[model samples]
Target: MTVTAADTVPAATLEPPTGRLSPLQQWWVLTTRGLLKVFRNGEFIFAFVSPALLAICFYLPLREAVAQVATIDYAQYLMPVIMLQSAAFVASSASMRAAVDGQEGVHTRFRVMPMPTAVPFLARAATNFVLLLVALACGLITCLIMGWRPVPEEYGGGVTGAAIAVLLVAMIGMALTLCADGIGLVAKSPEATSQLVAFPTLILGMLSTGFIPLNQFPEWIQGFVEYQPISQVTKAMRDAIGGILDWQRFEPTLWWTLGLFAVAAVLLVLGTRKAAR
Candidate 1:
C-alpha cells in the first residue's frame, strides 16, 4: 500500500548534526583561515614592496663606502636590519587590521563562534610572523642580487642569531597588537588610533639601530638608547646577521627580549579580558 504523503517525513527536513571542533582543532582552523585570508588579500606583496625598494635605493651609494672598511658585503650587513624594519611595519599593520576588525564587529562574531578565545589574536600573530619571514627571505635575495655573498660559517651563525632576534620581535609585535586592539576599542575613530600609533612607531624605529648604528650617537645618550627594547633587539639582530658572533653582546639582548615578552604576556591577558567585557 502506498503511504500517504503527510505520513512520510523526509530525512532532509531533520536538523543537521552540529559538530564542534576540539579546542586545538579550532585553533588550527582559525590560524589556517587567517593565513588563507592573508594569501588572498595580496597583502604580502604590498607589505614588502616599499621596504624592499627603499632598502635597494638606500644601499646603492653606501656600497662603495661599506666595501672600504669591511671584507663582507655591506648589503648583506644591512639586509637583516631592513628585514627588521619591514617586519615591524608588517606587525603594526597586522595589529591595525585586528583593531579594524574589532571596530567593525568581526571579532565579536568570532567570539560567538566555537573558536577558542586565543585563536583570533594568535592567528594574527602567526600570519604576521609568516609574512615577516617572507619579507626576510626577499630581503636576503635582494642582498644576493646586490653582490652580497655570505660565508658558510658566518651564514649559519647569522641565521641562528636572526632567528632569535625575530622571535623576540614577533613577541613584541604580538604584545603591541594586543595593546593596540585594546586601544582601538576605546578610540572614537580610526583616525584617532592612527594618530596614537604613529609617533611610537617613528620614535622606536629611529631610536633603534634600524636606521643607523647605535654607536653613531653621542656617548651619554647611548646608555638610554641601549636600554630600550628596540635598541636591544636591533643590536641583537645586527650582531647576529652582520658582524662576528659575540655571545657577550647577544646574551643580554636575548634576556631583554624575553623580559619584554613576559611583560607583554601580562599586558595581553589584561587587555583581552578588558576587551571581552
Candidate 2:
C-alpha cells in the first residue's frame, strides 16, 4: 500500500509554534493580541468618553457648590479619584477579557499549549496596564481642562514631586490590574467579575477623600472614610501631587499597596489551579 506524503509526515511539524517563541516573545505576542482586541473592539472609545462625562457631569455642577463651604479647588480635589477610577476601569476590562477568553476556548487552548504558566495572565495584565495609562492620560487632560493643575504649592515637592505622585498612581494602577486578573480568573465569567468588582469600587470611591474631603463627611463614618484603602490611596496621591508627602501619610499607603500584591498572588494561584483542573 502506498503511504504517500501524508503518511511520511511527522504530524508534529504542523502544530503551532508555541514552544518556538521565547517567554518574552510569547508575552509580547499575547500582549499585542490583547491590545489589538482592545483597539478593534472599540473598548477604549469609552475610556475617552468617561473622562469627558466626569469632567462635565460632576465637575461643572459640583465645582461651585462645593466651593461655597470648603474653600478647596474642586478640580484638584477630584483629580485623584478620577485617576483611581481609571484603575478600576482597567480591572473591569481585564475581567471581561478573561471571561471572553474562557467563553471562547482561548483559556483551554493556552492550557494545551507548551508555554509558561504566567504568560497568559501577565499578558492580559500588561495589556490592561497599557490601557490604564492611556485612560489616565485622557483623564488627566480632561482634569487640566477643568482647571486641575499639579502645582506643588502645598507639598513644595514641585515638578519632581508631581512626577513622583503620577508614578505612584501608575504603580497603584498596575497593582489593581493584577488584582483584577485574579478575580477574573476565579469568577471565570465577565458578568460575575464586573458585579464583584463594582461594589467595592463604588463604595470606596464615594466614601473616600478623593470624592469628598474627609472633614466634609459626617462625624460617624469619618474614621472609615479616612482610613479605607481607596481613601488612603487618594489622600496619598493628593499629597504626593501637592509635594507634601511626609513619612506619616506615605507609610499606610505603601502597606496597602503591598496588601493588594498579596491578594493578587493568591488569586492567581487559585484561578490557575482551577483552570488546570
Candidate 3:
C-alpha cells in the first residue's frame, strides 16, 4: 500500500480536538500516569532498599551508641528521624527528575497538551509521598528486627500515632520537593543541579534532627536549629512516636511546616510557569 503522507494522516491529526480536560480529570489522569511510570521503573523497590540498607548499615550502629547515653531506646527515637531523612532524600531526587524532564522538553509537551501544567509537579509529589511511605514501612521493620517495639498501651502509642507522624513527614517531603523544583529550574543543567541541590539538602539532613538530638548541640545552635523546617518536622514526628502525643505543643511545629510548604508551593508555581514561558 503506497499511501501518501497526507492520505495516511489520521482524521484527528487533520482536525485536533477542541475541548480541554476538566481540572480534576486532568490531575487524576496525570497523577495516575506518572505513578504507573514510576512503578514500571522499579522506583518502589529502589525506595525500599535504599532506606532499609541505610537503616541497617548506618543507623543500627548509631542506635547502639546512643542507647548507652539516652534514657529512651535509641532505635525507637531514631526510626522516625530515619523516615524523615529517607523522605527528604527521595523527594529531592524526585524533583530533580522533574527538572530533567523539563530540560528534556517533556514538560513542554505536557504544557501544550490538554492537561493542567501543575500535573507533573503534583504527580511527582504524590510519587514521592508513596515512596516515603514505603521507606517508613521498611524502617519500622528494621526497628522491629533491632528489638524496638511500640508500646501501644503506654500513651496510646500504636499504628494511629505512627501513621500521623508519617503523614506529617511526607508533607515536609512535599515542601522540600517543591523547593528542589525551584532550584532545578535555576540550575537547568543536571550536573549543576546535582551539586547545588543535593549537597545542601544532605548537609541540612545531617544538621537537622535526623542524625543527632538537637539538645546535644550548643544552646545558640539549638535556637536556630529549632526554627528550621526539618527540625520542626522531626520534632513533631518524634513527639508523635515517643507517645507524648501532645498536639498542643507540636501544633507550632506543624504550623511552621505548613508555612514553609506554602512558600515552596508559591516558588514552584512561579518557577514552573516561568519555565513554561
Candidate 4:
C-alpha cells in the first residue's frame, strides 16, 4: 500500500467528535439506562407492593393486640416502621441490581468507557432514589388507608411535621441504598447480595421497637432495643410525625444517620477501587 498519514495512523488514535456529551449529559444518559432497567425488571411495581404488603400484613393482624396493650392508635404508631420498611425495600432492590450488573461484566465495560467513575455510581443511586420515592408514597397511601394522619399542630402547622417525617424517611433511604449498592458491588452474586441485604433488615426491623413497644420486650433485651439504630431512627420518625421534634428526641437518629453515611462512603470507596482493578 502507498504510505499516507491515514494509512500510518491506527483507528484507535482517532479523536472523539466534538459533539460528545458532557459529564452531566453522560450522567443523564446512564441514569436513563438504569431507570429503564429498573422498569423492565418490575422494580417500580415491587416498590409499591412491598410497602403496601408490609402495612397490611402487620397492621391487620396486630392492630387489636397493640390496642389492648397501649392507648396509642395502631396505625399512627405503625407508620414509622412502614416508612422504614419501604426504605429497606429500596436498599434490597438496589443491592440486587448492582450485583447483577457486576456479574454481567457491566462494571468492567463501564470502567473502559470515557465516562467518569462516579457517573455509573450516581446514575444507579438516582435510579434507586426514584424507587425509594415510590416506595415511600405507597407506604404513605397504606398508612392513610390504615388511619395514620399527621398532626400539623405538633410542628406548629404549615406541614412542618409532615415535611420532617418525609425528610427522615428519605435520609434513611439514601443511607441504606448507598450502603447496599456498595455491598452489592463487593458481593459475589445477586443471590449472595439478597441474603446479605435481607439479614440485617429483617433482624433490625423485627427486633426494633417499630412493631412492638419497648416495654413489651423482655427487660434483658430492652436496652438493646432502645438504642439500636433502627429503633432510634423509628423513634425520631415517630416524634416528627407526632409533632414533637426536639434535640433530645432527634439526637440519636441524627448521630446514627451520620454514622451510616460514613460507612456508606467507606464502602463506596472500596467498591469503586475494586471495580477499577
lDDT by residue for model 4 (114-217), tens: 88888999899889898888888988888888898877583432267877988898997899899999999988889999999999989999999999899999
Candidate 4 or 2, higher TM-score: 4
- Which residue runs does candidate 1 get wrong by more than 4 Å? 1-16, 22-25, 61-73, 152-189, 192-198, 242-247
Best by TM-score: 4
* lDDT (Cα, 0-100) at 206 in candidate 4: 91
lDDT of 1 by residue, 153-221 (tens): 534545565565456555555555555554554555567767666667668666765545566668888
Give candidate 3 regions above 4 Å deviation. Answer: 1-29, 218-220
* CA shift of 52, model 2, Å: 2.1
Choose 3 or 4, whichever is better by TM-score.
4
lDDT of 2 by residue, 1-277 (tens): 8788877888897677654888899999999999999999786987777777766877888888889879899998898888778767877788777777876778768977889988998788889988998888887777788888777565566767667777777888888878888887788578888888878888888888887677888999999998998899888877877777889988888898899899999988887887887
lDDT of 3 by residue, 1-277 (tens): 7888889887788886777778777777777877787788777777767667767776667866766666666766667666776766666666667667767887778778766676766776666666666766766666676666665846645777777777777777666666766666655676777787677767776777766777777888887777676677777777776567686858876686677678677767776775678
The alpha-carbon lDDT assigned to residue 22 of candidate 2 equals 89
Tell me the deviation in Å of residue 106 in model 4: 0.6
Candidate 3: pairs in clash: none
Q: Rank the candidates by lDDT, best first.
A: 4, 2, 3, 1
Model 3, C-alpha of 201: deviation from truth (Å): 3.0
Model 3 global lDDT (CA atoms, 0 to 1): 0.70
| Alpha carbon lDDT at 210, candidate 2 | 81
Best by lDDT: 4
